[model samples]
Target: MTTESSDARPLPTLTRRSGDDLRCSIARTLQVLGDRWTILIVREGFRGHTRFSDFRRVLGIPTDILTSRLSSLVEAGVLERRGYREPGARERFDYHLTAAGDALLPVLGALAEWGNEYRPSGHGPSRLYQHAETGEATSIAFVTAAGAVVPLTDIAIVPGPGENDPGVGPTHPLAAHH
Candidate 1:
């Protein structure tokens, strides 16, 4: 099913105030990327589009809103801005997703897959990815080399003393990150 703009994933709703510990890695990551348009911008960047006008045209996003989102993404190091110029035209800005942003593609793909499965749809997915080698419709799943599907599992932490706990390292990979 093709998700419409109105399809029911609501905007992220986390808030932090001064002196609050938004220190968890997941929370910190969300703080930078939790904005509605950030991932979409990364998506487009991966598609080889760089210029402001290209993004504006493809996304149909408002210019100011796009500007703000782009700015935020750049500030967060998810994107890099570079200048380009055309003959007889003004210098223009372009954006490209950084490695950190590209790393989120799998996460986005997973979310898209979930929405397709659970959401009601008279038709099946609007589009399907095909396996190039076999020419069969394909989707991504977490599986072992032996083809065993893996279920999500809780990750346990072994902490040492330092910052996270008394003897923990200065930064816990699981804590306060983006």
Candidate 2:
């Protein structure tokens, strides 16, 4: 029996997420946080980049794209704009991360770990996450219902309190495919 060549690229699986009935938190989240630009903006905000000019200078992003992303973040309650004046300058907006935005640290950590492990950029990691008190490097993991951190092998996904049939039910065709 012959196997497919290792160099072969697999065909892309086409699927459309059910946005109309997006009762899933992850779906609703992706809509607001949007894309890599939005996520990177949030990361920079966490890194203490509050001003628009600094975001543009560091990210090298176009003003229009930065403007749109900042607006969307504020609208989503993930960021709050505060009036600030630098020395002799007139008042300008500084984007501050909200409580909801602060809660995404775990998600960011998980994504960073996955990227470093799988889809590397050849350049070694540019930054590291450390525990504030212990000063040790930190990593993310899946925890159990009992609050015990466990390996992916030890975990199981079952129905939870938030589980519901929101029109696009659990049996939705795309659900199994994913």
Candidate 3:
């Protein structure tokens, strides 16, 4: 199920199951932000939580668990640490989302959409993303290269030049529905 890549150098002969873990982008993304608490912490970041106490209080998360998740987020380049102190206080670190972390907005939006759509708990949207200028609620969607928004059935799975196995992605457990 290999495809030909037109690159001068060969890409890694890898899959999601690769030992070095450089294969599937999704797998690597999960490795960085795989856990529930980790994702929640990232969500809190998007919600403007920077201080450790803010996350702990808002999420009702323990100090040690919040600390570990913040460390992991920083290590994964999803968040950056900044030192802050009051005039008479000792310095402490605050976590802010890096560019990589900012890129996760859509992922979180998609997850929120899914929860709102399928797992409704009789509540409305927890929060809404609004256009800063227009104040219109924003939503995530699949857009084509032609700039057309299309439905899932319109999308297709094909081998990319670097794809090691066409069978792997299309039939993957997560993507199987789509």
On TM-score, the candidate that comes out on top is 3
Best-matching candidate per lDDT: 3
Ranking by lDDT: 3, 2, 1
Could you tell me every candidate's TM-score relative to the true structure?
A: 0.65, 0.77, 0.80
lDDT string for model 1 (88-174, tens) is 998888998776666676667676688798884768765455676988876666566798865434222444222244554333343
Q: Which is better, 1 or 2, measured by TM-score?
A: 2
Per-residue lDDT of candidate 3, residues 1-178 (tens digit): 1122232122222235674356555767777787889999999999999999899999998889889889878877788999999899999989999877787898998999899999987978888778989999888887877889977666666555556764656433334575
Give the per-residue lDDT of model 2 (tens digit) for 1-178: 1123343222222233764424455656677775888999999988999999999999999999999989888877788899988799888999998877787788788889999999899998877889999999988986656879976555545544455744432333334445
Candidate 1: segments with Cα more than 4 A from true spot: 1-15, 18-21, 120-123, 126-149, 153-178
TM-score preference between candidates 1 and 3, better one: 3
Give the winner by lDDT: 2 or 3: 3
Candidate 2: residue 2 Cα off by (Å): 50
lDDT for position 108 in model 2: 85
